[model samples]
Target: MREAGKTLDAALGEQAGLQPTATILKVIQLTQQHRGLSALVLGGVEGVKDKREAKQKEVDEAYEKFDALVKDFNNKAIDDAWATPKREWQDLRNRISSGAITVPESYTAHTALIPKLLVVNDLTSDLFGLSLDPDVDTYQLIQSMYYQLPYLTEETGKMRAKGAGLLAKHEATLEDRQVLAAIIGRVNDRLTQTHTALNKAFVANPALRDKLEAQWQSAYDLTNKVMQLANTHIVRPETLEFPGTEYVAQTTAAIDAQFAVNQAASRQLEIMLNDKVSDLRKTRWIMIGAMAGLIALAGLLARLIARSVSMPLQQAVHISERIAQGDLTAQIDTGGSSETAQLMRALKAMNDSLVSIVSSVRGSINAIGEASNDISTGNADLSSRTEAQASNLEETAASMEQITATVRNSAEHAREADQLVGSATSVAARGGQVVAQVVDTMGAINDSSRRIVDIISVIDGIAFQTNILALNAAVEAARAGEQGRGFAVVASEVRSLAQRSASAAKEIKELITDSVQKVEAGNALASEAGKAMHDVVASVERITGIMAGIMMAAQEQSTGIEQVNQAISQIDEMTQQNAALVEQAAAASESLQQQAATLQDAVAVFTLHERDAGYSYQSPAQLTPRKLSLVSINGIA
Candidate 1:
């Protein structure tokens, strides 16, 4: 750290000394004042890392910077020193900065002993380690003359004082006659020119013309006294670095060489960069093609696997969906796979089973319908037979009632005649007692006979009148329109009934006539009997006491005959009813047989399988109907 501090202090001192400032001595004199400054500057020129770092950090830094990043370590150190110019770099920098002058950076080969442009600077230099031309100090005396002169101020004082300083510094002797005279001559000529310029300037200005001559005369007298003193000290100019034409020639040549080298390097770098860009483009294209080919191969294999497995499975699923929707005709195109074949076989079997079941159900329903129809037919036939039998029985019973009434009436009449015969014989006993009583009884006999004839004639006439009315109604019915044809037929049957009644009436009239005759005869006999009955009454009173037994016996016999007639009539009526029932039943049985044949034809339309579908249609017992355990005609069983 301490060595670094000392180095920093020494570098600062060299930088300050090299910077342009107003001073009497040359740059070499300032460097000689600090021996350490020379060594420190040399070390910085070697690119000491810490010193470079320290310089960058200095505030308000006045140094010009180069592109240190582009240069090597040694080049950077040397270039940085020249970046902001000392006296060595100043003219070149000024040419670049200003438009006052130009120096050629590069030169063409020319026919000259000297170079193209001469750059004269203070540096003691060489041209490629070769020295040339005259002794450098001889021309050095000429270049120093202008620089050594002091600025002329205070009229003549500046030239005299500046000459005395130059003589003292070069140690000019009092006996150096030619050097002294030249110095004296320059001073005298400059003083004369100064006074002339002042006179012309003042005389043209009318305000200062009077003061101008006095001032010049006083300044000239003082300047002569200064020259006598300078004569005492005048010698020669100092020995210093003043390399003239040779120095400029060397620098110009060096600049030309550097320019050529840089241009060649720039051309080479661009060639390398273009080659790298072309190589990158080719390599990138090759890699892209390889990657694309690999991807295409992978995709092809994936598609092959999917088609073999997933596509077939998808077709199978579609087939199943159609079947579930009740489209049994749907078929899968599995391209001849065993699983597809099995599925098709199963579906076909299910369809066949469903068809068989439906056919069997239809067959069973037909059989049940036939059995119900047959039962209904049988029931209708039985009801019809029962109705016919009931009607016939009613007709036969009516005929039997009429015959029994007639037989009963006859038996009563026979009992009444036998009683009269017994009374007439008893009347003889009363004939001797009175002739008048015999005549009264004969008159009563005539009256009773006449009443009997009258009742029988009225009954016969009523029967005749009823028959005529029935015949008249039949004729009226027959005259009605065609719609009354059924009534006409019924009326015709009534007319037949009436005709039979008329015949019965005729027979009844004849019977009545006979009965009237018998009654008249019975009355006559009774009158005669009444005469004898007077006498007979005496015997009859004895016989009526004894012959009441005969009358009782006759009444019992009549009652027996009436009961026999009733029994015969009932037997005849029962026979007629049984015959009617038999005929009706036979007709109904034939109709039922015809209906059975029709039902059999109707049931034959559909087909049924023989295989038992787990149910029976009907029992064999159902073919024969009986009244036993029959069901009602709803769907109960």
Candidate 2:
């Protein structure tokens, strides 16, 4: 059906091409007329300028129609093929209108452009699929319209221009006669080809003959008259006497006649193509209707077949749904031995198995709930005991910590005391050394005091001698009268000074003796004190050694107590972890009990028998075991 639609579309597309082809043919005819009339006017013939202008207008109008049709086609090949001839036509028309083209040049230009126009016509036919028409009738008609009639019209146009040029000039050269003769021969040949093509079209579709035969004969007669007139008056004689206007009129009539045949053939081609498209469309619709009927029939049969299979399957599905919803008591009708019936029997067996499994699972759920509850209770008690043990261990650890701190402090104090005793011993030893030096210095000072006493006695003896000498000097001075009396006063003062010096020497000797005695006493005391300081240094050294031993013992004791405290703390941590584990176990057991209760409730939805002796319930150990996660201990993930 789809292929038929495409065929219909192609037929319609071909039908759409007909109008453009007709417009191109019309443009060909008008341009050919304008060509002949322009040749006549350019040959200096009278009364053809307006005719040429009017024919130009008609050509222009035909070009406009052709352009409009080409636009509809949107074929680049058609547009490109037409461009040269259209430009040439405009140039030729302008040259003729402006009197810039001689008759020969005008005629040559028109002659050159006509074949290009014919080429465009052929291209337009091919574009529209007219040249490739598959049907015998349309193909024959297209040959005539696209080739034969256009060729005949062009030949007639050439004859018209050549004969009209000769008649307009009122003279015929040998070259002009030969050209007219050649054109006449071509016209006859084209006329023959056109006849043969029309005859074949008539044979292919006799109705075309009945419709277009009269116009075909009229065009044939007119073309024959034009060809005869050209041969008799223009080609055979050196002098031309026929009126150029009448020749042009007669030749144009003949060309128009051929165009009328061309137009008739085109109309018939359009009718045939339209009719073909209409037939294809009808056939497409008929095929569509037939396919639709077949589809409907197939659908009906499918529906009936689906009911046969789906009805039983739907019943099985309904039973399965009831079983899925835990309604195991749904009735099963396993009547037939078909696949559907087997499915029904299978569902029935599944339902019966579920009834038994549900009963077993219910019993299992009850046992699990009771066991979990007892386990939960036991875990709770174990958790409480573990918590209490952990607390006691923590308190013991705290006390041990305090004892360890005290021992550490005692050790520290003993170390400080030992250091103080060591320092005191050093100071005492230094004091003993200083005391021994002081005793030696006291002995040396006593010797120096004895020397001072001896020196004082010698000074006393010297003062006595000085006093005796002074007394002798005083007697002598008395014997010498007044001079001696002055000397006597000096002797008395010297004697008094000598006595005071002796007394002073005696007092200094006594004081030095007293100092020596005191120095001796101080030396004895220093010797005793030095011995006492030496004894004190020895005692302090012994006390320092004792304190060092005490400090070492205290440090060892403190380290032992700290180790014990660490052990207690570790034990406390272990107890704490044990308590947490017990609590987690209790919680897990409680959750297990709740889940067991939930499972029991969930299974309660199924209706089951009181007992099933055929199937035995499996124990948890005998059944598949689920994977369990181990609780983390001591932060090990």
Candidate 3:
């Protein structure tokens, strides 16, 4: 029972350890299943980020290309808005003064300025859309730069176109000069506004300042040239030359600044995305490592628990095997306060009980053997006396003339024979009682043997259960995989121990079963012996009745003596048969004694602490007394 408890505890502990691990494993599997989805989400984020980066690059390239286009148009506009108008007016002034061209012809030449003026306005409009597209309100310098700068450029172009058109009449009129003067004033106003706005943009966005300063100077110089040309109105000196190379440098720097701003924003975004991806990868590996560590720890704990439980049980099983083999000398140390310890204690106690019972039974058998010897001695004496009587009766019959004396002698002998026969009947009755008691004792022994079988059966059941538990532990260990291999070996060893225990229990059970069968056979033999003793008593009673008849008929002495001789012969024959039966009974008792010795030897393997006094007994009369007395008188003890 205690062993079973230990096995059950171990089983429960194993299951307890495995259940959580199984749950954790299931949870890990569930989480791992989601890993793919999580990876997909991360991949999607990366894809979107990549796409955004690509789109940003495309936008940057397009903006740079557009800025270059604006730079080209801006360069042309500067020439047309300022340098072109100045050079044409100076030519006209020289032609009129030197008298090479008429005033009307100069007027027709002034029409040439109209087309350049219109081209300058077109360049200003294109700059607004390409380089200075409005994003914020006009309050911001960036927006004001786009709006006001283009407005100033367009106003300058218009001023040039108007001044040239008004002066192109056949005669120079006061009204035409007045209109041209107004145009010059407006152009100066726009130039001042454009310069102020450009300076503000440089201040607000300092990154563009270095590059914008040069362009601002170029535009300022162009404004001054346009103002000079407008003041003369086809009358300036021929010092006017288009500043085309300076205009190109300013436009290039402006375009480069805008492209640089776009590239910086895109690069910053790409760096942030790269950092985010790196952090996510680190986090993923960390999670995977943590999960693996937890699983390893759980497996380690399970292995430790399995070893702790299995080792002690193996020791207990070894001890139990010795006990089953009738080797009670085997002792076990219960290592600690565990179920296996309790089992060891229980087995020790059972061993002690068996030793006491075996010792007591040995004592009882010895006592019974002594009583059988006494019965055999008494039976031998009775057989001798009967033979003596038969010889004397035959001698008296040989002298028929001494018939009267012989008749009286025969009557006296008949009374003595009747008394002896009554004694024999009393002895036979006692022997029958003894045999009945022996039958009862044998029956009791059979019952005890049966009980021992039952105890063995219980042990077998415990072994079987332990075997099942070990098998279960092995299966759990197998499920634990590589980490569980150590536990699996332990479980296998435990299973082997259980099997050995079961085998020992089975052998003990078989021994007990055989013992019970022998006991039952002994009981049946004892019962038969009791019935035989009763028949012996009946035969003795018949002899006693015939003896009484001989005492009553003394006058027919010869006839009675003849009958007496026949009865004596019959008594002698019966006495000889009783002697044979006594010998058989003594032989049976000796055989029983040998069986008891064998039983003692079988149990002698055990080392007992103390010997118990054998079982109590009744007086001989109460315990197979009939067989005792029958053997006592039959000259066989």
Candidate 4:
């Protein structure tokens, strides 16, 4: 169907391509007439200058139409071909209008431009696909329009130019006659070619022949007449007699007749191309409709097939969804022996298994809850007893601490008593040494008193001798008389002094003897006190040794008590830790009981068969209760 659409597009494009060929043909015809008129006017013919200007205008207008048509084609090669002719036309018109051109120059210029326009016509036909028409009738018609008819018209135009130029000059040269003869021969040749093309077109399509026969015959006759007139009046004669303006008119009439046939052929070609494009478009739509009908029929069949397979699968999906949502009690009817029925039976067995599994899980969860409760209760009782033991141990530790402190204080006091006894012993030993020195001083004082008594006895004996010497001196003085009276008084005074000296010495001796006796008594008492001090020093030393022993024993007792206290504290701390552990175990067991209850609640969401209710089953591992000690529980927990 898509390929048909492309063919239809191509046919329409070809039809569009044919549109510019008509304008191209029109430009060719107008330029040919303008070429003939240019020759006549430049030949100095009267009354033809205005005709030439007018024909030039007509040619320019046809060029405008050709420009518009070529623009639609958008083909650079065709446009370029048309531009050369258009430029030459303008230059010829300017030369003729400026009167700067001679007869041959003007005629040559116009002739040059007409062939360029013919080339443009051929190019336009090829651009429009007319030269390559697929059908025989259209192809023949294209040959006539693009080649045969243009060639015939060009030859006729040449005849017109030459004939008109000779007529306008009223003279004919041999060279001019030869050129006219040559143009005549070419004209005959083009006429034959044109007839052959038309005959071929007619044979190919009798309908085109019926439509174009009269125009073709008219063009044929007019072409022949123009040839005859040229041969007799312009080529054969040495001088010209026909009016140049009338000659241009007759030749133009022949060219117009040829163009008329060309137009008819173009119209027939357009009609045929249009019919071809229309048929292609109709066929494309027919194919499109047939394709659409086939697509609709396929879709209907596919829908019926999908319905047959999807319906059963949808039922199976629905049942599977129920199972996923934990509806284990859903019933299944496996009626058919198809694969889908087998799938339903599998799902039924899965549901029954789930019912049994869920029932067993529910029973296990209940048993776990009961065991956790019992464990929690036992932990609570153990916690109370452990706490009580920790409390009693705490009190015993406090008492031991007090005893340890008392023993430490007693040891400290004993140490202080021992230091005091050592100080007293040192003081007593010093007192004994002082007492011994005092006894030795008493003995020395007694010896000094005895020496003093011996000195007093010697003084008494000297006083007796002095008394006797005084008596002798008195007797001598009596003999001397008055002069000796003074000597007698001196002797008497000496005797008295001697007597007093003896008495004083006896008193000193007695006092010295009494002091020596007291010194002896004091020495004896100091000797006895020194011995007592020595004995006191010895007793204090013994007491210091005893106190030291007592202090050492007290210190050892305090150390032992402190070590016992530390042991009791450690035991108390362990008991506290045990109590805390018991509390933690009680809490953990309670949490386990709650978790088991939660598990039971979670399992309750699954709907089970009534026959599975109260169906308790325990595995061999769960038949007897497992007892775990505290150490094992601590490790596991």
Give the per-residue lDDT of model 1 (tens digit) for 410-508. 556655655765666545554644554545665675676567557656655665675676667667766777766777777667667766765666676
Model 2, 1-637: lDDT tens per residue? Answer: 7677766766676687777777777887887788778778878777778888998899989987787777776788888987888788778778878989887787788788889888888887777677776778788888988888888888888888877777888998888888888888888988898899889989988899899999889888988887888888888876789888888889999988888888777777778877888888888778888989999999999898788879998888888788778777777887888777888888888888887788778777767765676676677666766776777777788889889889989999999999899899889889889988988888898889889889998999999998998888888988998978999999989988998998898899789889888988888898898889889888998998899999999989998998898888888788888878888887898788668767766776776554542233333334443333445555431
Candidate that beats the other on lDDT, 2 or 4, i.e. the better one? 2
As for model 1, its CA RMSD to the true structure in angstroms is 45.9
Q: How accurate locally is residue 390 in candidate 3, as Cα lDDT from 0 to 100?
A: 51
Better of 1 and 2 by lDDT: 2
Candidate 3 local lDDT, 267-352, one digit each (tens): 32233334434554555567668768988998998798778768877877887787777666666675567776787777767777
- Per-model TM-score, in order, reads 0.16, 0.49, 0.24, 0.47
Query: Which residue window of length 10 is worst by lDDT in model 2?
Result: 613-622
Candidate 4 least-lDDT 10 residues: 628-637
Q: Which stretches of candidate 2 lie over 4 Å from their true place?
A: 307-637
Ranking by lDDT: 2, 4, 3, 1
Runs of candidate 1 exceeding 4 Å displacement: 1-249, 252-261, 295-299, 302-306, 316-637
Total clashing pairs for each candidate: 22, 1, 29, 0
Candidate 4 lDDT tens digits, 1-637: 6677765666666677666777777777887787788777778777777877898788878888878877777788987887777777777778888989987777777777778878887777676566766678878888887888887888888889878878888988899899999999999999998899889989989998899999899989988998999998888876678788878888999999888887777777778888988898788778878889989988998798678557767877887888788777676887888676787788888888888888888887767766776676667766766776677777888898888888988999999999989899888889888888887887788778778778877887888888788878888888888999899999889988888887787777678777777877887888788888888888998898899999999988988898888888887788778878888887887787667667766777786767776434332234343344444332222
Ten-residue segment with the worst summed lDDT in candidate 3? 28-37
